[model samples]
Target: MHTDSAAEPRLAGGPATGLVAALDIGGTKIAGALVDDTGRIRVRVQRPTPAREDGETVMRTVEDVLAGLAASPLWPGAGAVGIGSAGPVDAFRGTVSPVNVPGWRGFPLVERVHRATGGRPVTLVGDGVAMTAAEHWLGAARGHDNALCLVVSTGVGGGLVLDGRVHPGPTGNAGHLGHISVDLDGEPCACGGRGCVERLASGPHIARRALENGWRPGPDGDTSAAAVAAAARAGDPVALDSFDRAARALAAGIAATATLVEVDIAVIGGGVAGAGEILFGPLRRHLATYATLSFVRGLTAVPARTGTDAGLLGAAAAARTPRA
Candidate 1:
C-alpha cells in the first residue's frame, strides 16, 4: 500500500465546487484520490491489485483503497464517485469485465462502489475514455475541439473528443485504436483479430521485434523497449528498424482514425511514447504517406501533456461532467 497527500497551499481556498472521489483501477494496482475541480489530487492512496485472486478478493482490495480515501477529511465533500477501469467495461450496465483481470467478468463495480461510499452516485468509464477526458480538460487536447488521445504501452488504447466533449460511446470503449487492423494479413492478435495496431506498436512487441532482428541487449541485460530505444539511439540498425516498423503501424492506424473522424490532433502518451523522437520521427514520416486527404493532411500528432496522473484526473473530470 502507498499513501500520499498534496500540500495545503495547492488546495488553498479549496475547490470552488466540491471535490470528487476518483478510482483508477487496473490489473497492476487500484488507486484512489480526492480530486478538486482544478484537477489537483488532494489525497491519494494505492494498493497492488490482487489480479489473480477471486472476484470478491479483488473487490475487497478496491474497498480497502476506498477506506483509505474515506479517512481523509475532504472525503465528505466528495459528493460523487468516478471510476476509470481497465476494460472492456459496460457503462450502460454498470459492470466491468477487464481482459487482464479474468476474476472480474461483468462485475457490478459501480453498484458496489456506490454502496461503499454511502450511496454517492458512481460514474464509470473505460481507462482510455478517462484519459481522453483528462486530456480534453487540461492536457494536450485542451484547446482542440476534436482530437484523439492514445496510450501506447503494453497495449494501445485510446479515446476521442468530438465537439469539445469526451466520447465514451455506449459501451465505454469508443476510440479503441489498438484493435484496428493496420495489416490485415500480418499476424493474429490477442483480441482475435489480425494485424491490430497493438500487435505492432505495443512495448512488448517493439522489444520482441528488436530481439528477433538480432538486437542484443548490453551487459545490463535489460530487454525492454526502453533498452531497445537506447540501442536505436546508439545507431543499431536492427533496433531502429523495429521502432520504425512499430511507428509505421501506429501511423497507419492514426491516419485511418483521422480520415474517418476528422480529428485535428492525435495526443499520444504511455510508456512507448517515452522513446521520444525515436518513435515520433518515423510516425510523422509514415503518416505523411497515408494521410493524404486534404481534410486529414493537416492532422498533427503531439505528445500528451497529462502524465501518470491522467487516469485519476480524468475520472474526476467524468464525475464533474453531467452524463448525457
Candidate 2:
C-alpha cells in the first residue's frame, strides 16, 4: 500500500508480485498474511497471542504462521518477511522487549523471523511506526507530508512521519507519544512516570476510571473502554464523563504535539478510537481550549483508514527502505 509520490516509484497496489509475508504481533493476537507487492492480501491467518508465553513459544507461533502461508496458492514467490510488533524495539538490532508480554525482553525477533522463513530478509518495526507507515502509504493521511499518527488500542502508541520519510529517531522509539506527561500528578504509568498521556488516554486508563467510579452494567462490576463508549453513546453520565476526561487529556497532548511539530493532520487508529464522535468531538473541544498556536489551529484529527491490516502493510513497506 504505497502512496502517490512524484514519479519516485511509490508501490501503491502494484502488480501483486513477490509474496511478502506480513506479521502483526500484539498482546492478544498474532496475525500473519501473504501480501502481494500490490498490498492486496492473498492469504491471511490468525492465532491467539499468548502474552503469558515466553519468547521462544511466541517465536514458534510466528514460525507456525509461515508454515500456514506456504500452503496458499498465492504464496509461491515469497521473498521477505515484515513484522509489526509491540515496543520497545531496537529496529537496527532487530530486537524487541514488549513489556506486556513476558519473556520478550531483548528477543532477537528479526533473526528468528529470517530463520523461520528460510533465511529471508526480515524487517521489524514498532507497531506505532508501522501504523504511521500504513497511513502514509494507503490510509487517511496519504498525501500529507507531515503528520502525527496514534494508535489507541490495548495501549497508546504513536509514530511521526515528516517530509515524506519515516522518522525512527535515535533508538527506534522516537515517536512514543504515550510516554509524554500531560499531568504532573497523574496516575502511575508502567513506564514509571506520573500522569503520562498513556495513564490518562489509553484503554486501560479509561477502564481503571470506570472501576474506581463504580460504573458497570447490571452488577458486572467494571467495563472496558469499549463498553464505556457504548454506555456514553446511550447517555450514561458516568461513562460520558470518563470519555470526556480521556478526550480532554488526548486533546491537550495532541495540541501540544501539533504545536511542537506543526503537523498538518493527526491520524488516530486502534480499538479504543472506535469511540468515534464521542471521543473525537470532545478531543476537538479540548484542543480548542489548550492549543492557541495559530499554525496548529485548524489541524484535522481523522480516523485511520487502514484498519487492522495496516501493521503488516506498513512493516513490508518499511522493509523496503534502505537501512544505513
TM-scores vs. true structure, each candidate: 0.94, 0.91
Best by lDDT: 1
CA lDDT for candidate 2: 0.79
Off by over 4 Å in 2: 1-17, 219-222, 322-324
Top model by TM-score, which number? Answer: 1
What lDDT, from 0 to 1, does candidate 1 have?
0.87
Alpha carbon lDDT of each predicted model: 0.87, 0.79
Q: Give the clash count for model 1.
A: 0
lDDT of 2 by residue, 75-111 (tens): 6577767788898987767788987787799888877
Off by over 4 Å in 1: 1-16
Worst 10 residues of 1 by lDDT: 1-10
